[model samples]
Target chain A: MTEQETIGFFKCLADKSRLAILKSLMEEDMYVERLAERLGITSATVSFHLKKLEEAGAVTSRKDQYYTMYSINKPLFGVRIIDILGEKTSESEAQKEREKAYREKVIASFFEYGRLKSIPTQRKKERIVLEEIAKAFQAGREYTEREVNIIIADYHDDFCTIRRDMISEGIMTRERSIYRKAERNGGDPEPAGR
Target chain B: MKNRIEEFENYMRSSAEEKKQKIAEMVRDGRADEARAVRAGLNMYEVMTALFGAALKKTGEGEEGFSREFHILKDNVTGNWKRNLEAAEKHGDAEKVMIEESKLETVEEIVRKFDSLF
Candidate 1:
């Protein structure tokens, strides 16, 4: 199943009434009123849950005479949870876009004319600012402590705090008095000289 | 047996048709008020705002306390609303299923009432 289908399937199972209906259906294919009677819920409530189950692909129904008979969808029940949760789809792309936009927003909020206004208290926001400052240093080249201070000071007056934050956030690495930008691949910072 | 996903898609498509047919029958039979009430009940913003307002009032928070409470409430209610809206939009064209203007106006009126409290 796709992400949306997986979510729908899990959401369908989350409700007590729906679970009861499914349990009843598992025993025998029954009509809505019969299921409602067995579960001791109102027929209307049973119908509501059945519709949700149908939408989630958890239940199937067929028209028999004047009544619609409902039954458990065994194949859907057999679908592994790992398969449902592990499937990648467009939703993942959409989520990535949202994260990118949020990162941009945080960077925009904290930076003014390529300078950070203040260190963000939130770790996530601070990481974005530190990464932006990290761009001033070359990935493979080392800088003296003084050079690091000058580069970070250009962005914010509190160079020591910014430099320390960079090191703490893993955006940059410091060894002795030397500093270098950490190599980042897919947002994971790799320690320098390692 | 039908493919589960395809079965669901078909079921939703047919359900929408059935709803439209029900509404058409209601109109033809001169029960527009009942239909309108049902439609209004289905309006997410109206339903959410009403529930939020009730919960807010239940807190008994005065103006001094309302802002902090409102922020907490807004996060949860808006998050759920956006998720529901996104899911609905994904399944069908949102524009086609858009709520009527008068109903929206009513929702706005309800929100304005809450705004007055803060």
Candidate 2:
């Protein structure tokens, strides 16, 4: 079964009324009224559940005389749950694109002409801002502490907080008062002309 | 009779496949409604469990309150089946039957109880 069908099947099973209807049908093929009688629910309600069950591929109906008889759809139930749940589609990629757009929007709102207006209080917004600042440093090149401060101070007055946050968020790394953009930031750490 | 069952089965399989493909396309296009539909299906179990838990908590009033409430709710639900059967027998209008408000309220109460728990 596909994810949608799997979900529908499980959802059909979750209801007490539907379960009762299925249980009654399991013993013998029954029309709507007979099922209503057996299950002690109204025919309308039985029909309601039957419609859902039918959509879920859990039951099949047949016209017999003036009444329609319903029976279990055995093949549908035979499907593996893992197969249903394990299916992955492009929805995840779409979700990633949405998140990326939101990040860009946040950066645009908080920064003016390569300078940050203020430090964002929210961690997620702050991370985006820090990443924007990280772009000022070249990959693989080490800068003295003073050089790092000068670069960061140009973006924001509070160079100390921004600088420290960059280290904490893994946007940059510091060693022996020297700093370089993290490799994960896609910076080329090795300078040209080795 | 046998032929009809076989035909229905074939129809069901093909229709299910078609629906699956349609849903896949919807997901690829990032249709929010498709996501909501899938999520709604997945949430059924959670809703059912919450209802049952809330019902049990509500009926925990006395020594036999839990059991009594459970049976009452079961009967109320199952009783609808019987009532529908009876209505069909009398009026031949089984499809027009309605579930009682009391029973629906019980479910609503269960939902409220679940919300409180969270």
Candidate 3:
């Protein structure tokens, strides 16, 4: 099979239904109606899957009066599969360099390794407060402000200052002795997700 | 079912072998540079992704799927830069050259890995 067709085979197998349909058809040729029924899916879905397989040359179809018969295309299939599962072949060097650079950038950002805190001026007291709140919530059921403050101090010496900064930033609120995340503490009858 | 999966495996091997052969042919015909370039560009991840995408795009045998590379991902560096840098910025992201993430695998490696998983 040509490189283009081989690529197509990989693409076709990307879907579960397509894979199942292809698997089913490996047994024998079947019409759209038959395939849909056997797979417990709609005829439209059947048609869609068949179309992809057909274009990939994984299968072929022909007219049969009101029914359209579909079956696997064995020869092209063999070659395409062999190419994907076989030996190593390198891509263009120029392309590789360009792609590799892009990939590294992605990794660096993810494994930030203190790079995130590289910005010197700490304009974000919000993040600090968020960290405290997040940790407190690690209590799982969520807790009051007193508990959050205690936890913060447990983790940090400047816990009081952080708490004050957070309060000024409208992050947390003191309701009686309980500390709660300002947003989720008391919203409407409907939450944001709803 | 087992036989069909086996057949699929064989097809995958043959296709990859075919690609290697074709690249070898290019090198044999004195197009060494181009052949090397071609070899470097493909990996199992890319091949399977392309194949799966192609399959989905075919007449009615696949579903819509996209590879990792195909999806539009925000450049967080650029996003953060835009958020932070107040100075007269001369450049935006997507234009900037950046290093990619990790040690990439070849197509054969991807298939072997995938086969083991399945």
Candidate 4:
């Protein structure tokens, strides 16, 4: 059985009525009337719980002498529990797969639903970006106004602030809203010379 | 603006993995301190997971809001650890689970069933 079916089984087992039924059934199989009496629940309620447990692969009912006997479904239990609990020697090893599909939703709301959120500062290692943006300025090739904004914005959400920092760090200079390296070197010229 | 949750979770998992390996090596080499540290890590994982659960609003019976799907995985893994170490104690593997059983209450009891490991 799949995880949902397994989960369904546990959820079925979660109920008071079903648990009372299982605790009763652990001794021996019994008729529906006996179950209702032992559980002190109504016969209809007992039957209802039985059906759910059976659906959960927790129990099985079989017609007997003038009454149906309800007992723990060891075969199904072995299949589901052992797979998760990793038990071998289970009887249902070669049986057909029980495809129990529920609406399996993976609700990963990544805080990116409606607005453009900045990647948080905790994830930012400024040293790495400082080095990367420093490379954005090339030999005597100053960046235009928009280029500086884009470069700073790439590594940080607060571009204006980071731009100020870069200026303070002597990495770049701004004039007439454009930016350039404070002084471009032959600047460790690219080895491939491209 | 630090994503404390993600960092905390990753740090917890890798930290647990390291402890697990350390204990296994201890088992091989008969180093008892390694086993003790491993037990501590498992207990820490359990307590942190419970803290996460406590932060969430109770939505239904045992259904927690503000919790992630990874909680289930963590639950199963810790359950497996308890089961294994309990069996280990049964067979004279170590006293790690016993030490943890006294110090932590992270493993919530199964409904209607009560035990230290539960």
lDDT of 1 by residue, A62-98 (tens): 9999999998999989878777667667877768766
Candidate 3 global TM-score = 0.28
What proportion of the real contacts between chains A and B does each prediction keep?
Answer: 0.00, 0.22, 0.00, 0.00
Give the 10-residue window scoring lowest on summed lDDT in candidate 1 chain A: A185-194
Q: Which ten residues in a row have the lowest lDDT in candidate 3 chain A?
A: A111-120
Between candidates 1 and 3, the TM-score winner: 1
lDDT per residue (tens digit) for residues B71-93 in model 4 = 55446556766775565445433
Please, what is the whole-model Cα lDDT of each candidate in the order they appear?
A: 0.65, 0.65, 0.51, 0.55
Q: What is the lDDT of residue B65 in candidate 1?
A: 57
lDDT of 3 by residue, A31-124 (tens): 9788879988555446656766787788988888888799888776565545566745456754665554544444333222212222213454
- CAPRI accuracy category, model 1: incorrect
DockQ of 2: 0.09
Candidate 3, superposed: residue stretches over 4 Å from native: A80-194, B1-118
iRMS of each prediction: 14.5, 17.6, 18.2, 22.4
The deviation in Å at residue B111 for candidate 2 is: 64
| Model 2: residues with Cα > 4 Å off, grouped in runs | A1-89, A188-194, B1-118
Identify the superior model by DockQ, candidate 1 or candidate 2.
2
Model 2 whole-model lDDT (C-alpha atoms): 0.65
Distance from true position, residue B80, model 2, in Å? Answer: 74
Question: After best superposition, candidate 1 residue B7: deviation in angstroms?
Answer: 75
